[model samples]
Target: MTAWAVLAGVAARLCALGLTASAAWLIARAAERPDLSALGLAIVAVRAFASARGVFGYLERLAGHDAALGRAAGQRVRLYRALAHGPLPAGSRGAGSGGGEALTHMVADLDAGQDLRLRCALPAIVAGVAGTAAVAFCWALHPASGAVVAAGALAAGLAVPAAAAAAARRLGARLAGARAELAARVMDLTDGRADLVAFGALDFATAAAERQARRLARTERLSGGVSAAALAAGTAVQGLTALGVAWAAAGTGAVTCAVLVLTALVALDAVQPAIPAAQLWVELRPAAARVRRVVRADAALPPDERPHRPAVPGRVALRGVRVRYGDVPALDGVDLDLSPGRSVAVLGESGAGKSTLLAVLAGLVQPGEGLALLRPARGLYQDAHLFAATVRANLLMAKPDAGDAELRAVLDRVRLTGWLDALPEGLSTPVGAGGRGLAGGQRQRLLLARALLADPEVLLLDEPTEALDAATGRAVLAGVLRARHGRTTVVVTHREDALGLFDDIVVMARGRVELHDAGDRQPIGRAFPSA
Candidate 1:
């Protein structure tokens, strides 16, 4: 399809060149003799070329856009799938951080790659073919004029664009950086507006955003200036080249000279867009590099290459498990064993690696130097995410084919049955962005219901009852444990009331397991001295 588009574009430019030359010849010939009959074939040929030019130009645009859009769609799907399945490596800031700024930048980069095919490569290819044809046609008519036209075409099509591209390359990185910074600042202002106002920092945020906006505007002005200058230079070259063609063909008859000069002028039309195309080519390079880096990294460490799901879904063991974030260790030389159908509660202070341990079990964070073997597990993190979707839609993420009965059962298990029943729309009620419509406890219960619906062999809960009141927290915890009677479960929490219900209790300090005891005997505060 792309080849067809390029061919059509080249054909259209050639037709345009023919139309200009033929019209000039017919007018000059009729002026010499005042005889319309002598110019009949020339007039007919001019109209034919004009008509064909318009038709082929339309076809070229249609085919070119179709091919480019299809390619963009495919690339977007592959990139999204790669990011969805795994965590990006540490310190690698691709799509994970930068929030909407990163996502919008990535999408713009993909569009740039698509435009390279339609705008840069296609125009350059078409111009080359059409310019060569014009030079050859002029040579057949008058050899001396041919040389002059060829020189001008080469200067306009090659030298000017190359210089423009080189200049644009110098500014491309700075322009890209400014745009990203602006995007980040705008997103920060939007997402943090409430917090900024509460802390009396709204003015500070506004000033920062204005600074980034100014930088972006300055960079854009510079880029536009470069593009305009390059275009003006190309047009100047075309005018001088047209004059030279006419001077060289002066001895060939007035009619012939006029025809060749007009041909030279029209041939330059094909080269006029080349300067901007070259600038775009240079501008797309950094974005392409960023995209390729992410795609290549994703390819190197595929998400599916992790440890397989255990066959019997019973024991989970980790030995000498270690994970380092930069120089500091988040989990260091930790060992744990979870027996089948037993509940283990991990108690720790804020940064005691309890969450990291759960991540290791859930196969989210790979161990640096250790062995971790576990069955398929579903995790409910302390900050569980909820989309801006309906109640049923969110629940369907856990089990896509679940009916209303299954959904209602899981909601009941999490003690959200009464709350959901009281709603006007029940399962159909909308959960606003990040579950904004619901209270913190309601959101937590919904997340718990989702995890339960998944029914994995192992359940990992990170502060699952943190959002609820004392009475409600204890009831929800009991219900969760009861529902998982025959499955392995790991709970990471600071709460003490639920500690007695677990079969084993593990306390973590720093990055290591400090104590492990049977839940029945040891007091919660004694096990966790700081707590």
Candidate 2:
């Protein structure tokens, strides 16, 4: 992929060089009467070279785009898998991350990086190579001409650009920082739009956007100012080169004059496309730093690649399992064993590490201190996501070949049969973005359906019914009751109403197990008459 990408960039540049040389050659011919056959043959040579260059240019773009998009896709998939190996904060990895929306990492940053790679660096590097060689060739034609070309090449491509780039760095960095803050703020505002509007902060969000726009404008001015300076420098050099070539040609005559000036003009113009790409290098550093931080973040994640899944006998045990974010331990010295065919409840207020514990259990977070053993379970996830795909597709995500009848049966068990039936496409109805979407309840149900489809022997439920209403929540709870069947289910929830459902309940406070007992409440007796 890297080879293909590099080649593509080189090809686009070859074409540009051929086009410049052809234009110069054609101008030289227009002034004289060369033989018809020789002129025709020369024209054919340039045209063929230009045509071949264009073909390679197209191929280069195709290959580069594929490489870039493929790399971005791989990065996203790796990120998603990495997220799977631990817990996503707030249960949903798609959104609510402090970094803002997943798109920031997945689309925006990736696109920016890829653009720099394909459109800027490769082409500039290619042209730099070709132009350097061309300048040397022109010098061999005339030593004085060679000296001028070399001087102009370094001055235009290196010296001026270096100085301008240094000047633009601070302005560019500030603008980049502003853009990042704006992107994060946009994500935050979008996530909390309802709260913002209800609290009458819509104006504030708008003003925030405006402020970002103003900063962006300032950056634009800075960039424009830099580019304009580059043009001025190039024009001044070209004008001076033309005068020098013309003055030196006074002894050599007009033909030599034309040749030197033409060479100078062609080589000077070669630096134009190169200038922006060179500038982009200066602009892309901060973004590169941001992406590097994300990539290197994984390096700090302790390798938890256990060669084999432990045959943990129908019970989960966290032996001194601890996890710290920065300096604060989210789960510290935690210990527990969740047994088979039983439901355990973990209760804690926000920031008491309820979600952190849940993440550890789900295998999404690595404990800073100890081992988290999942006993006889595939995995655990909270508020799991469904793609912008069909209801059937979402369910099939767990077990792709599980039959439509099987799907309907699970939906019926989850009490979502009516919901699916009401959909325009029934089981095939799309959900999530750009689809015949579901509400929060429906989305959660689809997630639940996905989990159940896995037929996990032990169920880990993290606030599964939080999105549902009183009656609906109860119905979902009843579904869990039926679904639990012989499987052990560990749940983290706050509602006192769910106390009856568990065979045994464990309450957690500040990463410590506070309550571990069978229910004393009569609701369990009524709900499970046989028990």
* Candidate 2 per-residue lDDT over residues 1-531, each given as its tens digit: 477756665555555555655555666676676667656755775787778777887787787788777876776665555443333322232333322254355345556676777667766676677567657766766777767777777777777767777767766778768888888888768767888999999889979888887878878787788789877987787677667656654565555556667766766666656666767777665454444444444463334423123355346677787777888767768887777677776666665677777767765565667776665534545445666778888778688899999999888766798988888988877786523356777777777777787776667777887888867777777777677667777777766666676677665556666556675755332322111
Of candidate 2, the 10-residue stretch with the lowest lDDT total is: 522-531
State every prediction's TM-score relative to the real structure: 0.65, 0.59
Candidate 2: clashing pairs of residues: 8-60, 86-364, 86-365, 87-364, 87-365, 139-146, 322-368, 323-368
- Provide the overall lDDT of each model, using Cα atoms, as 2-decimal numbers: 0.80, 0.66
TM match of model 2 to true structure: 0.59
Candidate topping TM-score: 1
Which regions in candidate 2 have their CA more than 4 angstroms from the true location? Answer: 1-116, 138-151, 154-261, 278-327, 333-344, 347-350, 360-380, 384-460, 464-482, 485-489, 494-531
lDDT tens readout by residue for model 1, 115-177: 888888888899899999999999999888889888998999999999999989878878878
